[model samples]
Structures are given as structure tokens and as C-alpha cells.
Target: MQAQILNLMRELQRALGLTYPFISHDLAVVYYISSRVAVMYLGRICELAETAALVERPRHPYARLLLDTIPDLEMSGRDRAPVAGEVPSPIDPPPVCAFHPRCPHADARCRSERPELRPDGGAEVACHAVEEGRLP
Candidate 1:
């Protein structure tokens, strides 16, 4: 039923030349329905990019973690370590980057200064680690 609905939406999109702000937690569904993707953490856009590019090479730490949650059938045996810490409350989100608590690459700057969206390769990412070239 989900597949049928997605297919129908696609058909309508093409027939009517409509653009939809397709927001979904299902990465596969988002990839199928969206040309661009904006990854959010605590109500802030952490990264935005072409769907294919973001999937292929995620720039932000949170973006990478989100993509890692997707099951990769081809690499079923690979061991994946969960990101550390917990998501801060949205009502009282952390001062700096929302993902700092869980980010493996987070540093002092990430804890103190909020990052702004800046172009990095194919994506615009809001991450101190990405800005400092600390993350690959």
C-alpha cells in the first residue's frame, strides 16, 4: 500500500509539474520522492544536498549517523557502532550544535559556538567539525 501511494504521488508530481516539501524520517522514501534533502537536528537544518550526493557522501556528523541507521543489504555483516550520548530536548536544545553530545568528532568549538550552514563540496552543512576540516 505504501509503495502504491508513493507511485501515485510520483505520477501526480509528473502530471501536474508540482513540487512537494517531502519531509519524512524514512530515508528510502525521501530518496525516492525528493530531489534534494535537508537533514535536521533539533529543528535546525544540519545539512542540505542533492539526495544522491548526500547518500553517497554525507558531510555532517549527524547526517552520517542518520544514513548509517539505514540497513545496507550488501554489507550485512559490517559492524556499526551507534553514535554516543542522547538527543537533547528540542524545547531546551543545547547552546551550540544540537548533535555535539553524540558527535564523535565534536570539540570545544562545537560545544560553544553554533555552526551556520556553509557550502562544503556538494552539500551545505552546519557543523564545526566540517568547517574545520576535522571530518572527512
Candidate 2:
């Protein structure tokens, strides 16, 4: 039923020359339906990229974890990496990068400074690592 609705939406999009924000928590579903993808951590948009590029090479640690979490039939025997850590409270969250608590790439700068979304390749990413050329 969902697939049918998505197909109809796609048809409508083509016929009407319009776009729809198809939101979902399932990374696989997002990859299947979205041309662009945005990853949010603690209500902040951490990364935005073309679905293909993001899936192939995620620029942010949180986005990488999300893509890695997608179940793959080809890698059925491989163990899944756990989602990093507990999410910080949304109420008056940290003053720094929101994902710093769980980000493996986070450093002192990330713990103290908030990153802004900036263009990198074909994406807009909010990570000190991406800005510092540590990740592409």
C-alpha cells in the first residue's frame, strides 16, 4: 500500500511538475525515494547531500551511522554497528555541535563550537571534520 502511494505520488510529481518532501526514519526508504537527503541530530540538520553521494560516502559520523544501519541482504552475515550513544536532551541542548556527545569525530572544537551548514562538494554539511578537510 505504501509502495502504491509512493508510485502515485511519483506520477503526480511528474505530471504536475511539483515536488514532495517524503519524510521517513528508514534510511533505505529515504535512499529509495529521495533525490536529496538531510540528516538531523537533536533537531539540527547535520548533513544534506545527494542520496547517491551520501550513501556512497557519508561526510558526517551520524549520517554514516544511519547509512550503515540500513539492512543489506548482501551483507546479511555482517554484524551491525550499534547507534553510538544516548541522545542529548532537546530541552536547552548543549551550546556546541548537537551531535558532539555521540560523534566519534568530535573534538574540543566540536564540544565548544557549533558548526554551520556549508557547501562541500555537492552537499551542505555541518561538521568541523568536513570543514577542516578531515572528511569528504
Candidate 3:
């Protein structure tokens, strides 16, 4: 049923030359349906790029973590670390980078100043660490 629906949507998109602001936590499905992708955290876009580029080389820590959640058939024995820490309250979210609490590379600046989306490689990423080349 899901496959049929996705196929129908794809056909309609091709036939009508339509564009969609597709939103989903299911990365695999998003990759299949979207030409571009946006990764958001606390209602803010953390990363944005062409779907294939973003999936192949995510610049933001959150984006990387999200993609890592997908099960890989070839990496059967690899350890998968779940996104840690509870999501902060959306009503009164933390200041600065919303993902700082859970981000492994976060520093004092991340806790104090919000980062704006900036070009990082082929994608736009909103991360202080990425901006400073702290992340490889």
C-alpha cells in the first residue's frame, strides 16, 4: 500500500511538474521522494541540500545522526548509537543551538549563540562546529 502511494505521488509529480515541501522523519522515504531535503531541529532548519548530496555527506551533526539511524544492510555488525538525550520542550526550547545538549562536539559557544545556516561543502549547515572546521 505504501509503495503504491509513493509510486502514485512520484508519477503525479513527474506528470504535473509539481514541487512538494515533503516532511518526514523517515529518511529512506524522504530520499526517494524529495529532490532536496531539509533537516530541522526545534522548528529551525539545521541543514539543507540536494537529497543525494545530503544523504551521502551530511554536514550537520544532527543530520548525520538522523541518517545514521537508518539500518544499513552491509554494516550488519556496526554499532549504531541512538540519538541521546530527551528532546527539549518545544514551547520553551533551549537558547542557541537546540541540538547542543545532545551534540557530541558542542562547546560553550554552541550553548550561547545560535548558528545561522551557512555553506559547508555542498550543503548548508547550521552548526558552529562545522563552521569552525571542528568536525571532520
Candidate 4:
């Protein structure tokens, strides 16, 4: 199926000189075909950065959690901690940062007010703790 899809996309790209949008939760597939990446949580974009940068140095807590789940030689001997708690409903996200409820680094301000997407090094993150330099 993957082979067929790739062949079809190549054919379409050659015929029309246009690229097709591929959407999936599979990080591997996204990394393979995309030049940029947008990380989201609870219907909100938490981070947007170059694929390599985001994977190597994730700024958002949720993005870090997602990257940590990937199997890698660097983490061969270590146990990858699973992301905790259930995802909140997107239909009614929290008033503040939507990820605050599950974010281990969340502080008082994170619970009270929403954070804006701010540039952090090369990535953009919507985290109060990150903005205030509270995150270690």
C-alpha cells in the first residue's frame, strides 16, 4: 500500500507539478516526506519547527514526550517514560494552556492563563513556564 501510494504521488507530482498534502499521526511517515513539522495538542499548535530541530531538541513538553517515545540507539539502555493521563477533549479544552493539566512542569501561571506561541531558540512553543524561564 505504501509503495502504491508513493508511486501514485510521484506520478501525480510529475503530471501536475504539484505536491499532495499527507496527513497522519505517524511521525516516521511525516519525517520521511515533510520539510517542516507542526506539533499540536488538544487542537492547538504547541510547536512548529524544522523536522530535524524539533526531533533533536523539542521545546514543548508535549513534543518532548512524543519524541521520547521513539526508539533510538541513544536511548537503548534507558526506559522511555510513557506520556501520562488521557488527552482532554478538544471540544472543551482548558482555559489556560491546554497541556497544563498533563504537563509535569506546569506552574501556577500555566493553570490561570493561556500561553502564546513564542520563539524558543529555533522552535516555537506555547508554554508559560518556557516563556518565564521557569522550565529547567
Best candidate according to lDDT: 1
| Model 4: how far residue 122 lies from native, Å | 2.0
Sequence-dependent TM-score of model 2: 0.88
Q: For every model shown, what is its TM-score relative to the native structure?
A: 0.93, 0.88, 0.92, 0.82
Off by over 4 Å in 3: 76-82
Model 2 C-alpha lDDT per residue in residues 49-80, reported as the tens digit of each score: 98999998888878888877766868668554
Clashing pairs for model 4 are: none
Q: What tens-digit string does per-residue lDDT give for candidate 3 at 1-136?
A: 9889999999999999998888888878998999999899999999999999998888898988888878787876855556777788999988799998788898999989999999987888999999999886
lDDT of 4 by residue, 37-101 (tens): 88988878899898889877888888888888777866567555556666778898887888876
Q: What is the Å distance of residue 75 in model 4 from its true position?
A: 4.3
Error at 92, model 3, angstroms: 1.0
Q: List the residue pairs that clash in candidate 1.
A: none
Error of 1 at 25 (Å): 0.8
lDDT to native, each model? 0.89, 0.83, 0.88, 0.81
